[model samples]
Target: MPTPLYQRLAAHYRDAVAAGSLTPGARFPSVRSLMAQHEVSLTTALQVCRVLEQEGLLEARPRSGYFVCHPAGRPALRLNEPEARPLDPAAYVGMHARVSEFIARGRQQPVKVNFSGARGAPELYPAEALRQAAGRALREDPELFVRAGPVAGEPVFREVLAKRALASGMVIAPEEIVVTQGCIEALNLALRAVTQPGDIVAVESPTFYGLMQVLESLSLRVLEIPTSPQTGISLEALELAVHHGSKIAALVVVPYLQNPLGSVMPAVNQARLVNFCAEQGIALIEDDTYSALLDEDVPQRALKALDRTGGVIHCASLHKVLAPGLRLGWMTAGRWQARVEMLKYAQSRHNDGLPQYAAAAVMGSSQYDRHLRRLRATLNLQRRQVSDALLRAFPVGTRFNTPPGGLSLWVELPDRRDARALFAAALAEGILIAPGVMFSNVERYATCLRLNCGNPFTPEVAAAVQRLGELCLTRCRPGAVGSGAAGSAA
Candidate 1:
């Protein structure tokens, strides 16, 4: 499809804003002026501004017209990121119990507002469409309900997955893809295929807690690599770690829309990391759970796309943007394909046939593409609203990453505001949030926390956020800190 005229114009303006040519708080041209300058219809001009407005680049005023959304200098709503700290020494896992305790407490003390889990808004899910797809699959092969699926995957689902992999610039046959219970299982099998107990593995600092939990279960030691909030894992730091003799067996990373942090790795960075891993003989296990949430214009961020040595183990599932309940995930294990497949079977055996066919039915249709577009737009809007609300609701000196597109924002409390205290206070009031300490084993992120933008910004949610902010002011105690910025520097 040709690029929409409004989108092209919007991209142009977005670049100008990012380049500082159009500074923050600058006035946007009027609709008539834009039409005259671009020689387009009034509707096209209006659309360009509308897209910018939705993206938080431009703000519309009733009579003052549109200006830049974020003001030049206040700490609120800025994109300041936390300072990258030094890499800590490799160590065995110890956070699983703390996370479990936090979760258990929440189960006992249920909250009114939940910002803990990264799930999409209820309206974004295509319930009726999924139902129809399930019905079609059932009618086409009623025996699917009774028979076991192939150990790799149902052929229909694998075919669709192989075709869909092209979006990440990956070219793989259906046989190379190993279907699993979910993304979690794919990650587990990939790690198991490559490493043994007591082996050392590399993971991004403040990575998805699930990866940490998995490492803990496997009894593997971890080497935490510094990660950037804007671009993702630091290649220089990874090289430094490896150069200094950190015998890493494998590295688990999320190159696009990294969990908790919401960083999108640049294309060059992805290629370089792939080459580094391939040359060093390190298994690059990629968690691609959130890459589908990005726009089509983004560079092919998947490490598997540039994997020539067959070192990248690509893992992903539809839970983030598609049917969460489907429990379908697939992976390509590169040179370890056979071993990973065997591990998959030995671990869980073949998956059930019914859901695979149903997922394939929905994913094979044009409705899937339409659903992706809608889903991306919804996530972008939610991220923006939640970021804005955080700035408005949180205390001063606060910092946050205004991720380009994702379901959560990494928030740093201002004036030594404590996240654990916030978690405790919020829990008492029935509000839930993911504290930053759970994300890392070190003390660096003790004051930081991640807020899920997956839920809609309803009146109740907004009030809960406001209350949470009030709690931060009342319950949080001050302490010495190393450093912090106004917002993400992405």
Candidate 2:
């Protein structure tokens, strides 16, 4: 469990560079000198030097020794929390164009370091196990490949999902579950089932852009509620909105490992939210996509589990923890099961049976649990590594919250800094990051940003973080200019 010698050496130099002890263009100790100084073997010294080089901290000159090439440490900024802004009336979703442009740029010029999406690295998933499971399912049930299943889903897959739901403290019958293309489709179906055009829906402030797109596509008015990075959506603000005649029809919330913020709602708050929704006749749509990624020993119960009057609709997917390519997602619509089922059928006939059988095969076996255990551990470690890099690389005023269980970190830059500008500058350097303004319907969160920590923090990842830090420092410094130039590139 102790840190490896090479890693420790790398960290020491990384810290030195971050602390200004090692200035840019400064020469690093030779490999032999490093070995003699640290009493480490030549191989250990070489490995440490290689790691530092890979991290963009040290660079090798053709025939010369290694030299510190990274930017010097700047004064740490005072961490500032994003101020909660008032709810803005629903506006036309214009993020589609911006998001599309960002995506197109990434494709046109492939980014060296991608921190834009929330998906886990493919290496973290059990691809071989899933493939074997799918092969077995195909051999056992050949009909699954050729026959179309029911509108809701394949009965066997639904049954497997129902059994799996029990781990999250939900006990629902298989018939109540409806399979969809993914969580996004499930969300669309759930929103369509309970909401009408122009109806007011409450969402967490700084919510995922996908949800905003869904609301926009449906022509729904949004009411942004003040949310805490640590505790999730504020009940007090939500109750006030309801009492003040917001005419809110439905509430969509990501209670566990919320996107962007990575906050988990407390169990007490979860119960309170369910009861409040029931009393107020508001349908609560829970996006539980990341719920399965929580610690196995202390799994948090779903809001659907606490619903007594069937007012909670649970939407979840196995893509994040299992097979992302499968595009498998399910929804349990408590009281509006019929409506959701009908909406799903109308939108798209039942999901493909092939992937369902494949998923079912994996879920039914012990390999699924083992894979989850490894995934949870890997994600946690990756998150820590990224956090360390951010702290060391970013300016002093940078702020961030440690997520309880999630794949991304929400970072708040200095008040004077514009994350959108940083995003542009980073992209120019072949690094990709999610801007905070994309998450909000309003122009708030201009100083905030999100970083994907789902992938393992390899040397390339470390270098990317360092490059971002350098860019941020350049734009945010007291006498710095070119913020406009950075934005112009985008």
Candidate 3:
């Protein structure tokens, strides 16, 4: 598979912008000039220019040609080394009040700029297509709305999901799949099936707050293992904890494009983790929510694919990549399938049939594959644009690693700067951001923050980045207090 000509041309300019060669506000060549210089067709030249513009590296004036819009800024931040010590022993997960308040404010107040939520823009979804699919499903089976379906979900939907999972290297029967309201439900069920209250669960430090909330709700204690921004949770730390008699009941991890940090576990590590979990008799709860959004040429296999001992429980959803409003998610619990199914049935009888039918129709269509390709490209482009913006906006000494694929960028600010204060300040300006405290049970990442990169880099978004940069600079100055009191008034 050779690289497309337009992509090659786009890469040429992208490299220039990344380097200092083409400085900010530098005008790009005209379409005709580009064609002549590169010996390509008019269509290829136009596509190349469009790709750059979409990437936020170039802007087009009414009369002027496309010009580099990204300013020369500090170098990319260095990766944060994984912490070596064990996490602070905590019985409960805190920060519920703060997170609740943030959510309430987002709903009540009219935000000028939103950088908080991880959901993609509504326009990015295939809404009309899904609507059509729903209508077709309803017309095909008018009785679907009137009848109750199985607790394991609609049989047809599960069949489609089973077929689709094959692409990710998961081999499972339709009977083994259980549909839930969302991935959260699947995770909750998985956790409930394996362990009791007071049991210890191992999680990546600075993991998703929702997982912490789940642990808290279940009265489960957590052993936060050291995790890397590029490689995910450390196997050595995990083995040490197990060897030191941590008595870990289960391990919850996002194997591909992990949230917050965006780390993807290497294949070798995935194999090791599966084998280790099996040998230790610990159940592994794998969150595969973002797996479908991977932008890489060769998609990685799910952790469930290597489960020979039936220890890997896979949880996934389509909300991140497809129709979020559908609220459809599924899971395949290897050895714990029966327990998970029973728990799901007791909690919620079954998912709604209409949405499941609609999802099945969409997933079984060729259009779904096309939509994923476009979605992946758009997300990758947005990730780069946001990374460039962050590099230009934040002060020196900031640290972060560009994730291979995902919707977020985890940023570590200067030691003196408190991200909680930055969050409050940014909120006061009507720009929402997820402070680092929200992601961890402990206060390990107080100076860090996670930025959402699911949306496109429009002019409004660009201005918001600039404003956030200005706010950060102000806080970095001496005598600055980060109480975030200003946000309370708003």
Candidate 4:
């Protein structure tokens, strides 16, 4: 008889490792999904993964699931060779720094309304309460305040966070938690912990661009799975990528209210995704950054809540609700907690401890939920405002998604208009919007742009939209001159 399918999978993985194609710290396919892809049973896939684990090619990380291990003494690989550029300190700043600069000093004309942020209005923050909490933390716990914090962050804060997760139906424990500066750092840590340079990671086609920057900085090969604005990446497509021996280190996804597009995966898809990851022995990083803003009668179940095998690394931050300035984010890495904590120690120990205390105080005092409720109401109102504005302002042929909640709206421009150019033109008119090109790994969303709907409706914002409409009209006209003119400098 021919060698069994499980044996074949084990051999394929073994060969990939031997050839250094999969590299170290890469993730394997989930078993249930793999079974579906290969038309095999769960038992066979599990046996294959077990064989690989026993052979030392795969090591299981808690909560993170199984990953290819770096052989002892493997030097940390440098990702990309830095390019020579003008001697400017600002030029070397990372993507977030550039984004921050754009937010602060880039806009020349002062529009009446601001739509540049994917956040609730600044007024949503309980400024007085936070200031009081921070002051109280300093005065009451000077010992905790004046010391270097834990590598995973403060215990009491993490406990509070765990309780919060439990209340939300995520079943996380404090020990599995690692608080970070923000959701971005949590994402960065999980990526760094599981992936080495040259590893291929799978992501949604139109994912958060910042993550693409992370992958590029690490010199990781990116496998883009076609993502639907309504449901998420085709699960079948992802399964195919995994079965073809793609050395995917991890799958980073925002299952609830994904950025830019604002698409949320249904609960059934979420369960299938968890089962697939568990079956394939792969790690998943579930970013729930925007889930807190929903104001629906039926609460959607997070992917982490349905995870039976410890494969989903759940992450979120208080920034979207309580305050972005607080920069308080946490992750439950399940079995990957130790590795993630180690990386946290190696990175910066932690973002800041006092902020955690302040955040916990606000969250625990019952004020946080009330604040979130008000925020949801406000966001809902803004969501309608932007939706109506987009439909009314854009050309009749334009298309976009109307997400139930979240700050950004993904708009597809008519007649293949370059969003980058639109972005430049909008900026020249004292408007700022996220161009669609920024959301793709391969820069494929040139005809799209992400507009922030979190900002309140104001006359200036409406005027900016009208100006943007004029720009779109000009671009859509045939034989338009100088397509290259649209960009940040436009």
TM per candidate comes to 0.85, 0.81, 0.83, 0.75
lDDT over C-alpha atoms for residue 93 of model 4: 13
List, residue by residue over 87-127, the lDDT tens digit for candidate 1: 67889989899999888888999679889888787778887
lDDT of 2 by residue, 234-291 (tens): 8988988888778888999999888878878888899899999999999999999998
Instruction: State the lDDT at 13 in candidate 2.
Output: 84
Quote the lDDT for 14 in model 3.
92
- lDDT tens string, model 3, 1-490? 9999999989998998778577553468899999999999999999999998887778775655777664444446446667555545635565567567767766776688788878788888888888888898889988988888999999999999999889889999999999998999999999999999999999987788888888888989888887877678889989988887788899999988888888888898999999999999999999999977777756569999888989999999988988889899999998899999999989999999988988888889988888888888788788778877877777777676567677877887764477777777877778888887777766667677888888889988888988888888886552232433111100
Clashing residue pairs in candidate 4, if any?
29-280, 30-279, 30-280, 31-279, 31-280, 32-279, 62-335, 62-336, 63-335, 421-486
- Residue pairs with colliding backbones in model 2 are 76-396, 77-396, 77-397
Stretches > 4 Å off in candidate 2: 1-85, 476-490
Query: What lDDT does the true structure give each of the candidates?
Result: 0.82, 0.81, 0.81, 0.71
Give the Cα error of residue 449 in candidate 2, in Å.
Answer: 1.2
Ranking by TM-score: 1, 3, 2, 4
How far in Å is the alpha carbon of 287 misplaced in model 1? 1.0
